[model samples]
Target: MTRTLVVIGHGMTGHRLVDTVRDLDPAGHWRVVVLAEERDPAYDRVRLSAYLEGHSRTELSLVEPDFLTDPRVDLYTARPAVHVDRKTRTVRTADGDEIGYDALVLATGSRPFVPPVPGRELRNCFVQRTLDDVDALRAAVRGGQPAVVIGGGLLGIEAAHGLRLLGMQPHIVEFAPHLMPTQLDADAARVLQRGATALGLRLHCGTAVTSVDAGPDDAVRSVTLANGTVLDTDLVVFAAGIRPRDDLAVTPDLERGERGGFLVDAYCRTADEHIWAVGECAAVLGRCHGLIAPGYRMAESVARQLTDHPAEPFDGTDTSTTLKLLGVHVATFGTMPVRDSQAVEVTFAEGTTRYAKVFLQTSTGTLLGGILAGKTGSRTELTPHVGRRPPADLEQLLLPD
Candidate 1:
């Protein structure tokens, strides 16, 4: 007899779980049912900013037409799961429908963190997370206007770039002392700042928005900073951070992480033996990884467990990141040493256009971690060598040929 596997929230990781399960169990050992809150199917959220570049929705879609046509699979779009009855092993949807399952998976993902400030609920304030959010922003904004984006992290920078592409003057406001503070040091951020300013973006670092003031029409008129500076703008976009969607775990029996997200073991299994969680919603060993790669690994692990195959426990994940922001190349991988006592450090810089740094173990020549700013030609070659020894020409690894 085939068991019923119910998955909630069909985002990127959720889709991956369903896809992986079907591939491993071609014999139809599990009947899959997916409940997606979004009207559209899973899409490439990592490239969501491309939509601002006039890319159509279909271009971002990750699903093939025939992928969901399997007789054993059932997909319900625009349906959100509201409650989980672990006792009966059933999930209740907002539409008054309850679905029974032999096993359950939560891939609810995350939501953009909007800081609690005065007038945040006013019109024209947006959070860039989904296709609908982008569409709403594009429709509400006008060209040649000034817009303020809260946060200077990766998502905030991407939001500012998208707004600039729409012909709006974008200003970034971050509480950190420098841009990409989580990934880059102050010096590397200066290089990034130079590149961003060259593109006409305004930066306001080390400051927080105190309030978002509204105009006479109740639309956003201006935002006041904690430092007493006021930025006059009609729009405000918040990309400060993300918080996992773990509200469905209402019962105290369902443990949650200290930061947020459903608490699960290394195998992605929750406290309940029959229920598991993957993606941003699953806090494996008290930590939740916001990146897509870790979520994919979690999905694969859960798929293996359900298939009764030998599976390895998820000990940890590579937080390394490589990406282009505002036409500037940047990458950071492995463990970044904070003090001289930790590891031997090597550094190089070429004016304000290029900067590189690497940390190596003192005892062994093994690469610890590194950061690249302005140009990342060596990122592809150096990333794989993290936690291991690199080529003899360590100097050449920091510079482009």
Candidate 2:
């Protein structure tokens, strides 16, 4: 009898797993079923900003039909796994079909977290998550009106840039003292925020939105701030954060994180050895790996271990990230939250508002983490800086001094 490998999410991780399984077992020894909750097939969600900025669905798809041609791969879209039975190793769908599986993988992924502010039921207030979200946002702001984006991290800033690309006045409201509080240091955050403001993105840091006000029926009219200031805008989209899909975890008696994510071991195995987990929905070593690269690493590890390849263990790294904002370059990586023993250094730009700063461990002179702006010519060299300990002056290595 052929073993059934059921993957519960058709995001990037599930797509990667299917491809990996095919390469491992080309023959018809295992059946693959992907339970995708969203419509429009599997897409690259990391590029959703690009999609919102005018890129079509075809440009944002990572797995085209050619990749899904394997007869073994079965796709079920818009169908959620309603229940799971670890004792009998089966997952029941919304339609009451209990799909039996030998090895189960829940990659149910995450959902956008929306706060309980007033007027949340307004038609123009949205949480950016699915292609449906981008579509709704585009239609809402079709008049090229002013837009307000809540939050200031990666998603918030990127969405702000996307709005500016769509020819709307982008306004960012952040509760934190600095933009990208998780990614950039205080000084770096100010620099990037300045870059954003120069691009006509009004910044409202160090403040929280008290409530959203809707006019007439259920349409967003203006946003009220904690400071009692009301900013008039037709649209309000929340890029706040992500919440993992853990409704089915209870069905299998699986352990979950405090913030609600499936718990998994290094091999991506859950409490039940036969069932596994990966991606942002699964917490490994207490971390919800949000970046696509780490998710791929987890998927590759599980695939190799299952095929008897016996690959070495995966060491989780500080997921550093860089991105372009309305043509401005911004990035941050490792040891960003400075400690007492870390050495902080900086370099300003020659004529433009570009600069680079690095933080290092005082004792070992090892890179702790840092950020770069204006010029990203040294971005690719970060892999070598973090991957291995190269014996050289860090500044010289970063810019040839």
Say which candidate scores most in TM-score.
1
Candidate 1, 1-401: lDDT as tens digits? 99999999889999998998988999999999999999998998987789976799999998887677888789999999998888888888989899999999999999999999999999999999999999998887789999999999999999999889989999999999999888898878989999899999999999999999999999999999999999999999999989999887444368899999999999999889999989898899999988887898899899999988888887554567788898888888777766766589888888888888888888897898888998645676887788788777766777776
Question: Which residue pairs come into collision in candidate 1?
Answer: none
Give candidate 2 misplaced runs (Cα > 4 Å).
333-352, 387-393, 396-401
Candidate with the greatest lDDT versus the true structure: 1
| Model 2 whole-model lDDT (C-alpha atoms) | 0.78
- On a 0 to 1 TM-score scale, where does candidate 1 land against the true structure? 0.95
Residues 110-145, candidate 2: write the lDDT tens digits: 888787888877888877788998998888775468
**What's the C-alpha lDDT at position 344 in model 1?**
90
The 0-to-1 C-alpha lDDT of every candidate, in the order given, reads 0.89, 0.78
